[model samples]
Target: MRTEISADKVKGDFLEKVEELSGQSIWACYQCGCCSSGCPVAEEMDLLPNQVIRYVQLGLEEELLSSKTIWLCASCFQCFSRCPRGIDISKIMDALRQMAMEGGVDRFGPVEISPSELAKAPQQVLVTVVRKLSA
Candidate 1:
């Protein structure tokens, strides 16, 4: 597979964008592992919550984008609430996922559906299910 991996490549604007959306300074992360421990989906993730933060800090954009951990996160807010650093890990994940999708990073494969893809599905069944669950 063709690939690209570069460290310390995060553009300043990219960091600013993420910081703006997450309301957490990326530098504030202390790697306490609390986010990973509290994450309900961490066991199923390719990268733990703390690992994700580390990747972002290192500017490992491709690594972060290719990781399934972003999708695995159910965004239940446990990580965000339990974080001692007060870093909004969920929001950071959310920002990264959005940016990755916009950049056509292919974090999820062509046939694999990320949650964002579910919104574009022509079938109403999944939407109905989500609605019922959210209700």
Candidate 2:
């Protein structure tokens, strides 16, 4: 497939870092579909695991960097373990997640809560439990 991104589109070491961290060069993927078949989240992904690998191979930076599938990955390592080529599919997803975050796409979804909001739960129950334990 044709890609919108040229070699000049990527800046600095982003793609290099992705390849390093994922432990498999994009060129090594033969599109055998083993990774996609074993992926638990494959059915839910906007692009299948094999497709994502191909996009990366084509240097489709924008598409790979902004995909919802990157965040949807639960990091279960199933895909990584099952890949016949031994490509680290989970790490590829992780790298994609980092790229997406750096690009400000917010992979957690449209209305994800901020860290501050998640920490504001009531503390009274904890206090009561502590007091009871102390008695």
Candidate 3:
């Protein structure tokens, strides 16, 4: 929650890195809720798609990188389809995931899970987990 925004933070390297990685204009988003509204996994996300863009614009690297929302994105492109600015939220999420992994903020790995838990997980869940880890 509580984040301190300063001029330096607004113009930090984090913002540039995200933009470069995602290849999207982070400032193009104007807080419109269309991306969040159309996100299929919005209910499962800690931060909505639009909020993630806002965080990037503000250069809140720690908060953005730590969010589960980035990992939750399914890259279905629903947000991109609905965005008035044609922003592809999935690319942004991918960039954030990359940044988080670079910072050693991995959620978990298959090696860390018990065999019993792994067996209990659905096939789709396991596949997604493996995909995220590999990415």
Q: Highest TM-score: give the candidate number.
A: 3
Per-candidate Cα RMSD to the true structure, in Å, reads 6.7, 9.7, 2.6
State TM-scores per candidate.
0.69, 0.68, 0.83
Model 1 is weakest, by summed lDDT over 10 consecutive residues, at 126-135
Task: Tell me the TM-score of model 2.
Answer: 0.68
What's the CA error at residue 66 for candidate 2, in Å? 2.1
Candidate 2 C-alpha lDDT tens digits along 55-128: 77666777777666776677678877887787888778777776666666553431344466447745663453
lDDT of 3 by residue, 15-40 (tens): 89998999999889998899888888
- What is the TM-score ranking, best to worst? 3, 1, 2
Clashing pairs in 2: none
Q: Per-residue error at 90 for model 1, in Å?
A: 0.8
Q: Give Cα distance to truth, residue 46, candidate 2, Å.
A: 0.9
Error of 2 at 89 (Å): 0.6
* Candidate 1 TM-score, true structure as reference: 0.69
Per-residue lDDT, model 2, residue 124, is 63
Mind giving the per-residue lDDT tens digits that candidate 1 earns over 1-135? 333445436553556777876787998998989988878887799889998887777677677777788766666889878888778887888787777667765443434446786777666655543432221
